[model samples]
Target: MPVRRADAPEPERRDLDVRGTSVRMLSGGAGPDLVFLHGAGGAGRWLEFQARLAERFHVRCPSHPGHGGSPAAEWIEHISDLAFHYLDLLDTLRLERVHLVGASFGGWIAAEVAVMASHRLASLTLIDPVGIKVDGWIYPFLFGMDIPEIVQTVFHNPMAALALAPPDQSVDTLAFQYRQGAAIARVSWNPYLYDPLLRRRLARITTPTLLCWGAHDRLAPVEPCAQAWVKEVPGARLRVFADSGHVPHVEEPAAVAAAIAEFCGGIR
Candidate 1:
């Protein structure tokens, strides 16, 4: 399991209905609003990294509908559905603007939100995100791999990957994993794993964006697919973590946090 610092307290969890979708949110600290979005298949559990981030920012880590404790929304048709729902969430919370930080599928949603409502965003940080469809780029099917295989193939550090999996894979846990995978597929299946037209829409995003990628990412390699985001988004900057993979925040939290802190400093 990922080791928690001795100084870190357990996070507080709660639920709220955002636009008819029940959202489970893990909250901590108090400062500027920082919204953390996890990848597909993961839950707010990964928000442990956000606790450290909360030291300087009020962190709100919401379980995307259909993942973890959050109930699946019937109306969730596409990635854009998630983007709009989060907008509703901000409105419900009465936050004028927030620093958006997302990973994997959450990163894709952040990009969509920046394009659709950049004015409501203070800044954006994406870590090994996937959403745009690029020819010849094959996104590893995370749902298809067993936990061990996933850990070996998707994560650069085996220890981090092992920490991410449940201690014991009971029948109940396996069943829940399948159910979560199915729900994720429902919203992200048609074009295999990405929106076919999302790449063309990147230019409209006006938020100061930071794209961070793990150099060893096999799921979404940095060279072509992941690095493409830096070129597409106007004024977007890229940072590559040489020793990390898809989930850099978990693999190298300190480095990820430092990069984010620097990027967010300009906003405030």
Candidate 2:
């Protein structure tokens, strides 16, 4: 298969049964465990950026329930529910301490996880997170936008976004994308993406945090959002990607990965 040709994308695929619920994961690399919570789009797939992270740490990226391979549950409806779900995942893995990285929607989840319980967490990194409501932040209505619009909103370079597009987006693929969108809406629609209480709860987080933002991000103004993250989370540091959009990991993987390595390397 092309996935195994040349620079092989060799990730171990595993489905972990966490008490009756099944969690699908792509795991690779061999250092300290690094749990990655992905954005809405790239679920159940390993990308080049993941492989780069795996070069230094054992990277575990899970498909959020109902998004990709993971099954949806009746009890899961909001971001708080997702946060507890990941807590259970950590307990199931018996990982006492692991670094956590969340991108976009996943960054929101990571933040909740840190506040809910940071006993087992070593460090936290949030990449363009959007769970906190800041006035005049200007987040585009993610669900209202079409695929092209979504892509345009997320990438600084149009060609880079176009290059990643799948040639044949079959019906099943499109259906899956909508399902993910529905899942996102279920959690984000009520208060319009940002949790009303999350900003206040930020002070509860004790984990060392790195807030990463893209300078050219169209979804929201980078300065206010990043500044808010830094001010709210105690001792949190901010890093800005000068020429990327919402998804820096997709638009500028090497630079993002390098920043991550430097931040995570100091631990232990």
Candidate 3:
């Protein structure tokens, strides 16, 4: 529901065959290759954040398997499977020295991917990622909450979320949401969103990393989660948005996009 500017270029939708599994991708702009991995909710939607990035980078947003228009992959069992899948995706696309960005659950996947192959990425950006756990910090059970409550929990300001609200929750919309939730459950339900081994593996990531966080995040509180990531990932820097919550890109798209551009620009 983001207001599209007249000058914003329309993204091209294409289907990719990543190891025989068809993946849907929205790609546009004409600069360095930058791939964005969406959160549990934002898959397949080109938001204002991505549009802004498209102005500066050739943004490639692909829907994770089992989400969006992509069919579920039987081979995907754990979150690690997704990490390997994306590695294959990069090879399939013949992309090298890519700028990789991910948010929320997708952030977790990005971290796993970077751990396995940081050399493939030029820079890694994680926005409010939830791969590692800090003692005494607990993530809220998102599946237990209704859509409205989930919306409120994610956005610091109600009006910020309202500005991009969908017109209505039609049957198809609700079904799509349900399917996406189920896809999340498949990989994340066992340990309740955090991978026990991922924390130990983060040190393996040698890529230049940027950690973006919403200061007011209630889902994955910033004080511990953001700090934990910055501490574990070597040389990973933190950028906190004061007026946002869990989903800073959705709540403060322009600011988040600008920060990403600045960070990626400095990656050399």
As for model 1, its CA RMSD to the true structure in angstroms is 1.7
List runs of model 3 lying over 4 Å from the truth. 162-168
Instruction: Show model 1 residue runs off by greater than 4 Å.
Output: 46-48
| lDDT for each candidate structure | 0.82, 0.82, 0.86
Better TM-score candidate (1, 3): 3
lDDT assessment of candidate 2? 0.82
Kindly give the stretch of ten consecutive residues in candidate 1 with the minimal lDDT sum.
40-49
Q: Estimate each model's TM-score.
A: 0.94, 0.93, 0.95
Candidate 2: 10-residue stretch with minimal lDDT: 1-10
**lDDT (Cα, tens digit) per residue for candidate 2, span 205-251:** 88888988899888765877888888899989888998888888877
lDDT of 2 at 50: 83
Instruction: Give one digit per residue, the lDDT tens place, for model 1 in 1-268.
Output: 3566668767788889887788898888877899988886558673346757877788888888877635668788888888999999999889999999989888988888888999999999999888998667878777677778788767888888755675467886766666677777987776766887789899998999999899998888887876688789999989998889888888888778878988898767
Better of 1 and 2 by TM-score: 1
Candidate RMSDs in order: 1.7, 2.5, 1.6
lDDT of 3 by residue, 82-139 (tens): 9998999999999977999999988999999999999999999999988776778978
TM-score of model number 3: 0.95
Off by over 4 Å in 2: 1-9, 162-167
Tell me how many clashing residue pairs each candidate has: 0, 0, 0
